[model samples]
Target: MTTTATDLRAQAERHLRALVGRDDATLYDDQWAAIAALVEDKRRALVVQRTGWGKSAVYFVATALLREQGAGPTVILSPLLALMRNQIEAAERAGIHAVTINSTNSEQWAEVHAHIRAGEVDVLLVSPERLNNPGFRDEVLPRLTESAGLLVIDEAHCISDWGHDFRPDYRRIRQMLAELPGGIPVLATTATANARVTGDVAEQLAVHGGEGGSEARKLAPQPTVARPAPQPQEDVLVLRGPLDRESLSLAVLELSRPEERLAWLADHLGELAGSGIIYTLTVAASQDIAGYLRERGHEVAAYSGQTETTERLALEQDLLAGRLKALVATSALGMGFDATLGFVVNVGAPASPVAYYQQVGRAGRGLPDGARASVILLPAREDRDIWAYFASLAFPAEQHVRTALKVLSDSDRPMSTATLETYVDLSRNRLEMMLKVLDVDGAVRRVQGGWTATGQDWVYEQERYDRVAAARRDEQAAMLEYIATSECRMRFLREALDDPEAQDCGRCDNCGGFTVAASVSDAAVQRAGDRLTRPGVALAPRKLWPTALANLGLDLKGKIAGAEEGRVVARLTDLGLGQALRDLFRPGTPDQEVPVPLVQGVVAALADWRPRPDGLVAFESRTHPLLVDSLAHGLSRHLGVPVLGRVAIRDDSVAPGQGATNSAQRVAAVSRRAVLQTEPVAGRRILLVDDLVASGWSMTLAAHWLRAEGAEAVLPLALASET
Candidate 1:
C-alpha cells in the first residue's frame, strides 16, 4: 500500500493543479524558476520579493514539491491575525487540513494540541506570539518533529529591524527552531527586505554554509558573513515607463487649513464615485474624520488598532461589496488587505517614504486601469517641521545606535523608549520622536504596560555594537545622499535600500516634476516669527524630565527648592504638571504655598473646560507641566516662540491644530445655549482630550454627550504631529 516516488510526485502535481488551476508547462516566470530550482536542489532558501509579487505561490509550490519527497506537514509562522486567517481559509478551500492556534480560542486549544500530536494536520499556522507559548513548544512542536516538517516563516522580515514589519517574536524563531530535535528544513519568505535584513534572516536560521554548500545552505548563508552575489543585469526587471494606469490619476492639492483638509477629503470622496481609503496617523483622528464624512452622507468606514477583528472583517467585506464607499484608517490597513480600493489619500506626509509608498500601494490592487493616489499637504508649519525632522533622522548614524543601546540597557525593565534622557546623551525630546521611527522598524515594543524591548534577536553581541554601529552610519549616509539627490524619489528609495537596478518611476513627485519649492519669502518667515511671539502659545520641551520626580506627591520645593513660581509655570503646563509639583510639595506644606498658587494658576489656565448646548458643563484639571515643558522647549528652538506661560487644556470642543484659534471664545455661544437648555446636567459636563488626533473622533463623541446631557460647550484639543 506504500506510494512510490513517481506516484507521490504525480499525486502532488495533480493536487497542486487542482488548487492553483495552473499547469507547469504554462511557462514559469523568473521568480517561480528560482523557487523551483531551490526546491529541486532540496535546500533551505530565503526568498525576498516585492509586495504583491506572488511570494506565497513560490512557497506553496515548494511546499508541494517537498511534501511529495516525503516531507511532513508545513509549519507557517505568521505575525498577523488577518494573514493567518486568510491562509487557513485558503488551505481549507484547497482540501488541506490547516489549523491556526492563537490566544483568541481558549476552549478549542486542547483539541488543536491533540490534532498536532496525532498528525492530523497538514499545515499548522501560528503567530510568533503564539509560538512563545510554553505549551505550543513543549507539547505541539515536539510531536511534529517525528515527521520531518517544512518550517516556513512568512513575513520573515520581522526578524530584522531594517524590514518594515519588524516583530520581536519573529527574532526568537531561530532559537525556537533550534530547540526542536530534527533539522527541519526552514523557508523564510517576505516581500521586502534590504541587504541587512536578508542577511539577518540567514544568520538567525543558522543556515550558514559557504557559497559551495548545498543550495539551501548557499541561499541561507549567515547574514554577517554572506556577500551578496553580483546582481545580474538581466535579472533586474524594470517597469520604468510612465505608469499609464488609465484608471488612475495623480493629483496634489494645497489645503489652506486643517478644517479645509477634512472638507477637501469629503468632497473628494463624494466625487470619487468608487470605494476609497483615507490614511491618517491616529485612531482618534480617523474616527473624527470618518464621522464628519459620514455626517456629510458618505458611507465611511474607520479602521484602527483599537477596532475589533470581527468589525474590521465586516468593514473589509463591506468595502469589497461596494457597500462602503470610503474608509478612514491608520496605516494599519495597508498590510495584506485585499480590497479593490479606487483611491488612496494621505492627509499629510507619511513618517517614511517606505510607509508612504505602502499606503499608496493599497489603492491600485487588481484594478484594470489602476487606482488613483494623492497627498494633501496642509498649511500647518508644524507639518513642514515634522517632515524636516523625519528627513534628518532618515539617515542612520552611530549616534542613533548608541542611543538605541543606552535605551535598551538603562531601562529598569524592558522599555521601548530609546530617548529617555537619563539613559542616552541625546536630547530626550529628540529621542522620543525618534522612538516612533524605531517602532515602525520593529526595533521597540509599544504596549499599555509601557514600551518594552521587542527585537532582541536582531541585537548582535555588545562587543560588535561598535562595528554594527559603524556599518549603520555608512548606510545612513547613503540614505541621506539619496534623499538629497535630485533624482527620482523612487530611484533614491531603491538606491538607499541597496536595490540593484531601480529606474525612474514616472509617477512619483520627482519623475512627475512636482518638486516642493525650496524657498521661503521674508514676509512669510517674518509672519512665522510673529506667530511664535504670540501670547499663550504652546511649546514642546527640549527634553523629558524624570518620571520618578514627576510622580512624587510633593510640592515644588520638595523637588527643587528656590525654584521660581513663574519658571515652574512656564516649565510645566501639561496634564501631569500640577501633580508633579504637588508630589514635590508633599512633606513640606509651607514650601507648597508659593508653588500651590502658581501651580494652580498654571493648571487652571491649562485645565480643560467645556460647555454643552443643553446647559451641561465639563472641567478637566489634570495638567502635566512636563508635557508642555517638553513641547515649549522644542517649539522655542524651532519656532522661536518666546512662550512666557504654557498650559495644557483638556477640552473636547477645540479642534486639533486650533491652538491659536481662540477655542474659548468660539465655543462660548454654544456653551451658554447648552447650559440654558439642560440646567440639571449643566453642572456635570464631560470633557475629553488625548495625546494625538488625526481625524477627531474622541472630540466629537465627547461633544455629542455634552450636548445630550444639557452641558455647556464641549471643547476638544489634542497634541499631534502631522503624518
Candidate 2:
C-alpha cells in the first residue's frame, strides 16, 4: 500500500519533464539523489556541484512534488535578482506558481502576499539581504519560516567567511537555519565551494531550530535581549561531485603590462568562440578596458557596482542575444547571470581559483553539441596591490569594534548609520558590514532606526579571522601557481575546488591543445599604449564638511566655501599611467625630482585649462618632500609662474597617512594641521601641488588655509589621485 522509491522517481521525472518543457526530460542521478533526500526523509542537504549540472532542476522538481503532497510553498534564498528571474520561469513551466518579493518589485508585494495567503503560490524567492530587512524580517519572514514546504539556500558558499565572495547578509542564513522547524526539508547549494568552505557550511546546516530564538525588533534602545542558543540537531546530507565541464578549455596568457593585456584582447576577441564576459578586478579597469574595446569596434559595455540596475538588465539581454561580443565587468556581473555564454576571458586573475572557477563556469553552459568554449586569463603585476586594497576592508580591528559597541550600548535612541558614522571612523560600507556580522554574532542588532548592541560579551575571534586571511593568501599563491603550473590546467582548477575526481582535462595549453596567440601586433600594441598613456583626471573639490566634526574636536560643518575645481595627471588606479605613479609613490621609493614623463603629463593637463595659475604652492610632504617640492617648482618654472612657498604641517601629531582613512577622520586630522606659511598668499590664483590627492580632504583643508589667508582663488594639481 506504500509508495515505493521507484514510484517517487517516476513522479520526480514527470515533474522534471514539465520543468524542462519536454516529455523525455529526466534528472541526473545526483540531482535525483538530492531531491529524494529532501522529499522522502525531510532531511537537510548540501549540494555542491559544478555549474550547469541541474542544481536548479532538483529544487524545481522537488517543489512540484512537495506542493502536490499538500505542503506549503517552497522558500528559496537566492543571491541575485537575475537568478530569481530564471527560477520563477522554470517553476511556472513545471506548473508550480512562483512569486518573489525583492528590492526591484515593491508594487507587486501586496498581490504576491495575497496569492501566498490564498495558497496560490508554490515557491517564493528572496535575496539574503531581504532576510534582515526590518519589515520583511519582522513581518513576512516569520510566517514563511514556520510554514514553508522546503528551504533552499542558493549560492551557499557565501555563508562562509572563508569563501572568496563572502557577504555579511549570507551569514544571516545561519540564524535562519537555526530558527527553521525541525523535520522541514532544507537544501543548500553552491557551484564553487572548496573543502574548507563546504565543511563550514555543512556544520551550520546541522543546527536545529531553537524554541525561543531572539527577535530583531526595534526596542527602546536600552539594553537588548541576547540571541538564542542553537540546540543539537540532525546530520546534513552532503552531495559533492567532480567539478569539471567538458565544454570548457582553460588557458593562461601571461603579459608583462596592462597595455599588452589590452592589446591581446583587442587582437583576439573576434577570434573567440562566441559572446561572453571579460572580467576585471576593479571598476576602473572595467571602464577603461570597455572604452578601449569600444574604440576598437567591439560592441561592448562596462558593467560594475556603479552600473544602474536598468542598464545592467539591458546589457544582459544584449549579451544574451549576441549583439555584444562581451561585457567588460567587475564581479558585479557574477553569481546567477545565466546565459548560453560561449567564452569567459579574465582581464586579470581573480584572487582565488574558487572564484576563477565560478567566473569561468559562466561560459560553455549553453554550447551546442561537441563544441568547446574558451576561458583565458591575462594576469598583471598589479594584482597583489589590488588584492591588498580589498583585504583592508575586511572585519575591523578589535579597537574599532569595541568603540562601535560602546557607542551603541550607551545610546538612548537607535542611531542611524549616518549618526554612527560620526563616531566610528570606518567607511559607511565597511561599518554596515561590521554591524551585520556583529548582529549575527549576537553582539549587536540592526533595528528600525539603525544598530544597537545586544549587551552580550562579544569576543573578537581574532584567530578565526587570521586563519581566513591566511587562507586567502594561500589562494592568491595558488592562483599565481595556476598561471605557471605545467600540469593540466582544468585539473588544476578542479583540485583547487577540492574535486575528488579531478583528472587531466588533456586539452588545455599545457596539454598540447591550441590556445590563442600570445603575441600581439606592434600596431595594436601602439594603439593600446596610446590610449593608456594619455592621462588627465578631473578632480572635484570637496564642497561640504563631514558631519559631527565637533565629536572629533573640530568645529567645521556645512558648506566648504574655499574648495574649487582641481586636476591631476591621473588617478593611481588608472589603466595606463597608474603603474608609473604607483611605482614612483611606492612606500620606500626615494624622494627625488619628478620623472620627465610625469612632468610632460602634468604639462598636457595644464594646456587645456581655461585660466592658468599665476603661482604654485606645495604641501610639504613628510614622506616625499623632495618629490612634492620638485614637482611644484618644476611646474612653476615651466609655466613661468611664481613659487609661493609650502603649506607646513602645523600639527605633526596628525600623521601624513591619516588622509587615507574614512572621510570624518581624514578631515579631522588635516583641518587643524594644515597651515599656509607663504608670505604671498594674497590676491593670487595659487596652484596647489601635492604627491597625491587620495581623499581630497588634504587639498580641501590646505585650500581652506590659503583662502583664510586671503588668496583670491585656488586650483589643485596632484601627480596622482585615488578618488
Candidate 3:
C-alpha cells in the first residue's frame, strides 16, 4: 500500500504520542521532520548528527510509524550487546513488540527466527556480529524479503575504516542486503563522518544522487528485481560551538608529584557532589587509582576490559541511578554510555585529541547546562618528556594501513596471540587489538582453536581497509600537527576539522597558564677528550646484554672483552680511563642545573689542554665556561639576538689544544634548548620546534602546544632526522 506525505505525518504523530507523550510529539525538531519525509518516501537515508542530538528519537519515531502502517519488520543492527538490550527495553517500554538475538540466546534463537518470518515481531535488534549467523540469513531474512523491510545501521561510522572505531563486519552489511529477497531500504546513521566516509557509504549502498542521474542506471541489471529508490546524500548539519555548560567549571591541573596527584583527586571528590568518571590509560592504572580513591572514603567503582560484561552493566546502571558517586575507567566507558549528571576527568594525556573529545562528550548528555572535562598532568620529568615526544610524532595513514595489512596477511591461518605474533611483525599486544576490531567487523571468525578469515571478498575488503587506514593516518597526522602548533588549541582544532565556530575554550593548560618553572639548569657536562676512548657508550649496542647491567652501559664492554683475546677485560677497563671514554660514558639527569664534581689538579691541567693525535683534547674548568659562553654568543649572533644561554660546560685534561672537535663539543652541539614558555594567542603566527624528526613526534607536539598557546598558524621545524 502506497502512503502519502500527509498520511505518514498523521500516522507518525499518533505513534510518537503513543510512545512518549502528546508533549513529546512537539519536541520533534526540523531535522526529525526531514528524516520522517524520507521514511514516508520509502527511501534509504543517512543521518549525521552530533552526539545527543536526538538521532535515535528520529529513527524510533520513523520505525513506529512504519510499523503502525503495516510496513515490514524493521531490523536494527547495533555494535554492542548492551546497546541491543537498551534498544529492546526502550521499544518494550513504548509498547512495541521487540525481540533481540545476542550472545546469551541459545535456546531462543530458533523461536526468534520463526517469529520474524511469521511477521509476529515488529522490530528486531541484533548485534552486527550476529549477522553472519546462517540461521538468520537462510531462514528468517528470506521470508522478510517478501515485504519491504526497513534496515537501520546505527553508529554507521563503524563501517568506515577512517572512523575512530572501524568494524570488519560492517563491510558484510552490503552483502547481507543483496542476499535478502526484496532489496530492503537501509538507514545508516552516525555521530561522526567526514566526506570520505560519507562517500564510502553511498558507494557501498549503491545509492545515486543528482550527478549520477538515477541509481538504476548506475547499477548493472541483475537477475533479482530492485525493491525501492535509493536515498540521496544529506548535507551534514553542524551545530553551533562552545557547548558551554553553565553549571560545570572546566579546569586543568599540573601536579608536581604522583602522591600529590592522588591527594588532589581525593580533595576534589570531597568537594564535588555530582557523579564523575576518571579516565586512565591502562586497566591496571584504573584499578590502582580507583582503589586508592575508595580508600580515601570516596565511593568509586572501576571499569576496564577485565570487568565482566554483567558487572560493567550493573556498575553503569548503579552510576546512572546515583548509587555510585564516581567511576574510574579506561577508554571503554565512553561509547554508548548515557549519564546526564556528572563530569569526566582525564588522569593523563590522551592518546589522541579525538579520544579526549569523545570521553568529554560523555557529560552534558541532555542537561540544559553543559558538563565539565579536565586533564591532570603528573610531576615526573619522564612523564613530561614522554608526553612531549608523543605530541611530536606524525600519524601517516598509508604507513598504518601497510602495517595493519602486513600484520593481517602474515598469519597464514587466522591465529590468536601466541601464534599470530610469530608471523606478524607487530607486538603481540597490538596484534590482539587489531584482531578484536576485525572480529567485530565480521572480517574474522573466532573458534575454539583460533580465528579465521571468514570474509568472502578479501580483495575488496583489503582495499576498503587500505582506504580507511590511509584516511585515519592522514587525520591523525593532521591532528598531531594541529596540537603541536603554537596557536590557540581551539582555533587549530576548528580550522583543521572545518569547525567554523570554534572559540578560545579558555580551559586548556596553556590557556590557564598552568606550566610550572624548571628547578635546575646546566645539570652536568662531560669532558671532550673522554669521549674518544668511550665511543661505545655513545652508540646503542647491536646485541642484547644481560638485563642486570643493561641500564649501566656495562654490557657493551663485556661484548668488547669477548671480541678481544686474553687481555680483553684489562683493555676494556683501560678504555674507560681514556679522555674520550670518560666524556661519552657520563650520564646525568635532564634537570637544567647539574653540579660538577671537583678533582685535584685536573682543573689546572685542563686550562692548558691541547689536542692529541688520537683526536682528544683537554680544557680547564674556568676555560670550559669561557668556551661555552663564546659558543652561546656566536649562536645568539647567528640566530639574530640572544636566544642561546649557558646550558652546560665540559672540562678535559687529555690534550690542551684539542678545540671544539672533541666528543664533549659534539655532545653540546647535539643538545637542544627546551622551550620554557608558551602562551595561547588569538591570532599570532608561531613556529613549532621539535628535537628530532623521527616519525615527526617532536614536530607534532610543538604544533599542538603552539595551537594551545593561541597561535594563528604553526609552522613545524625539526632539528634532526629520526631516521
Q: How accurate is candidate 1 locally (lDDT)?
A: 0.48
C-alpha-based local distance difference test score of model 3: 0.48
Off by over 4 Å in 2: 1-4, 104-115, 210-234, 609-611, 678-684, 704-713
Off by over 4 Å in 1: 1-27, 34-39, 68-70, 144-148, 177-183, 206-256, 271-274, 369-489, 508-723
Candidate order by TM-score, decreasing, is 2, 1, 3
Write down the lDDT of every candidate, Cα atoms only.
Answer: 0.48, 0.84, 0.48
Task: For residues 593-700, write the lDDT of model 3, one tens digit per residue.
Answer: 111221111222222221111111111123234432333333234334323112122333322222112122211222221222433343554333222222222233
- Name the candidate, 1 or 3, with the larger lDDT value: 1
Each prediction's RMSD to truth: 14.1, 3.7, 18.4
TM-scores vs. true structure, each candidate: 0.56, 0.93, 0.56
Candidate 1: Cα lDDT at 178:
45
